[model samples]
Target: MKVDYIIVGLGLAGLAFSRELEKENKSFIVFENKSQHSSKVAGGMYNPIILKRFTPVWDAENQLKIAIPFYKNMELLLGNKYDYKVDVYRLFTSIEEQNNWFAACDNPTLSSYMVPKVITDKFNGIDALFGYGKVTHTGRIDTNKLIEDYHFYLEKSNKILYQDFEYNRIDFNENKIQYKNIETSKIVFCEGFGIKKNPFFKELPMQEAKGELITIHAPELDIDFVLKSSVFIMPLGNQLFKVGATFNWKDKTSIPSKEGKEELLTKLKSILNVPFEVVEHVAGIRPTVKDRRPLVGLHKEYKNIALLNGLGTRGVMIAPTVAKELYNHIENDMLLRNEISIKRFENN
Candidate 1:
């Protein structure tokens, strides 16, 4: 089979790149073994602010500028509503934090997303003693539904192969990539944490952080917007909230641990005063890097192979932008920015 490209792995990065190919009428086949669960089990929030430090995310404005319309277009194409425009309410722990939020709101870039007013409105079952700061233009993408539906669409079109892509099987000397009977001009690896197993690209540093989330059915908690305190509790409709996530650096396994659940429960108690039932607990490893920027660009040795990974905790917001940059860089011979490009690690 002859195709323009063979994309390995079908997480957010893979899907975004596939969409770019489809837009340009490029034919490609995707190989996926469902090894990565980061995108599937992600919190899926596209907040522009770094909630931890009350600052804007890296390239937040441009990322959301492309991401919102990008996903909205996908919703139209896939016929599913995945984007939810939910405001994020940051629970203030102290008066200092509240002042900091107000100060962040004055930033020329952050002024758009951060609310100037501290919301004094009390929410039931939420222990916000110092009020909350509501952020605008922030929301959640039902990435689980988006991925599931997109896979169905790919399967229907016969564009996806449900199997492993062995690195040793690829023949790179033929001017084109050859894997068994298939031949392609290039290959893009969106393998998430699974990229560690890839021989050609495994030398790149990848710090996989295992994260866990719990779903709770809290009928009495009546807040529609996302509440961020000790942890973020997002509404999932029908009185269900998705609470998460604990970062464990040592655990490479995706299996939910007893320690993870207990950690979430402990944090959950600090934020909630209402009765709730734990519905589910899930875990996945996030493809993180030390510098926290995504890993993008072609391999130094293999020009035809590209990587899109290390989206970290902000995959929903970063994936679309990086995917476009990678696609443009590969297809149009465009110059890549130094920060996200894999070449930035050349000295190391």
Candidate 2:
């Protein structure tokens, strides 16, 4: 079959690009093998402020401006409650940390999201001696729900093929590429950790980090906002909280390990004083880059082959903006930014 494009993967990156294609009335088919876990098992939190160093995320404002409306429109189409607006409270451990919190609020970029005052209110299960710093305009998108519903939509529309896409099978014609029986003008690889298997773009510098999260049933810990300490505690409703994310550079696999679970529980116990049981444990490899920028652009040798990946830990926030950039770069002949463009690694 002939099509405008063939998207290999259905994660956040692939989904965002598909929307871009749909907006332009472009015909495309997506191939999926369910090999990636990062998008499916993501924490799905979209916080502009990087709590680790209390700095503004790179292009946070612009990303949110496009992302918020993008997901809202998806909800209207799919008729599912996926985007949730939740507040994030960064718990302070020491007086010095509290001072840093207030100091960060003075940043012009950070001032919009950072609340100057420390939240001194008591929480039942959390131990906050120095209070918490609240960050506004933050929320979580249920990525799992979004993926499932979107796949259903794609299936209903007969736009997605549920199978592994073999790169070696691709036959480049004069203007189009043929993969098995299908021919397309372009093929964009949105593969997450699966990019390693891609011969065309696998040589690009990519550092994969395996992250694990646990869902706990904490009935006593009543909190409305997402709590960030050593680990993040995100409220998942029905007396459940999704706490994550241990970044392991050593472990490349997506299987949840005992060591990973122990590490989370140890950190969880330090900040939380309530009794809780682990209901679910999941692991996924985040497609991270050394420079912490997304991988977007077409292959240097093959113009029709493109990529959208390495979104790191903030895939939910970065996907829509980068996808739009990639689409415009390819279709409109617009130049890609040097940082995210694959040209940066061509010299390597």
Q: Give me the candidate number with maximum TM-score.
A: 2
Error of 1 at 9 (Å): 0.4
Write down the lDDT that model 1 would get.
0.92
- 1-348 in candidate 2: lDDT tens per residue? 989999999999999999999999999999999988899999999999999889999989999999999999899999999899999999998899889998999999999899999889999998788999999999999999999999999999899999999989999998899999998999999999899999998988998899999999999998989999899999999999999999999988889999999999999999989999999999999999999999999998898999999999899999999999999999999999998898999988
Could you estimate the TM-score for every candidate? 0.98, 0.99
Candidate 1: C-alpha RMSD after superposition: 0.9
lDDT of each: 0.92, 0.94
In candidate 2, the residue pairs with backbone N, CA or C atoms under 3 Å apart (3 or more residues apart, or in different chains) clash, namely none
Q: Which stretches of candidate 1 lie over 4 Å from their true place?
A: none
lDDT of 1 by residue, 239-302 (tens): 9999999999999999999999999999999889999999999999999988999999998888
Location of the lowest summed lDDT over 10 successive residues in candidate 1: 170-179
Candidate 2: TM-score? 0.99
Question: Model 2, 72: alpha-carbon shift in Å?
Answer: 0.4
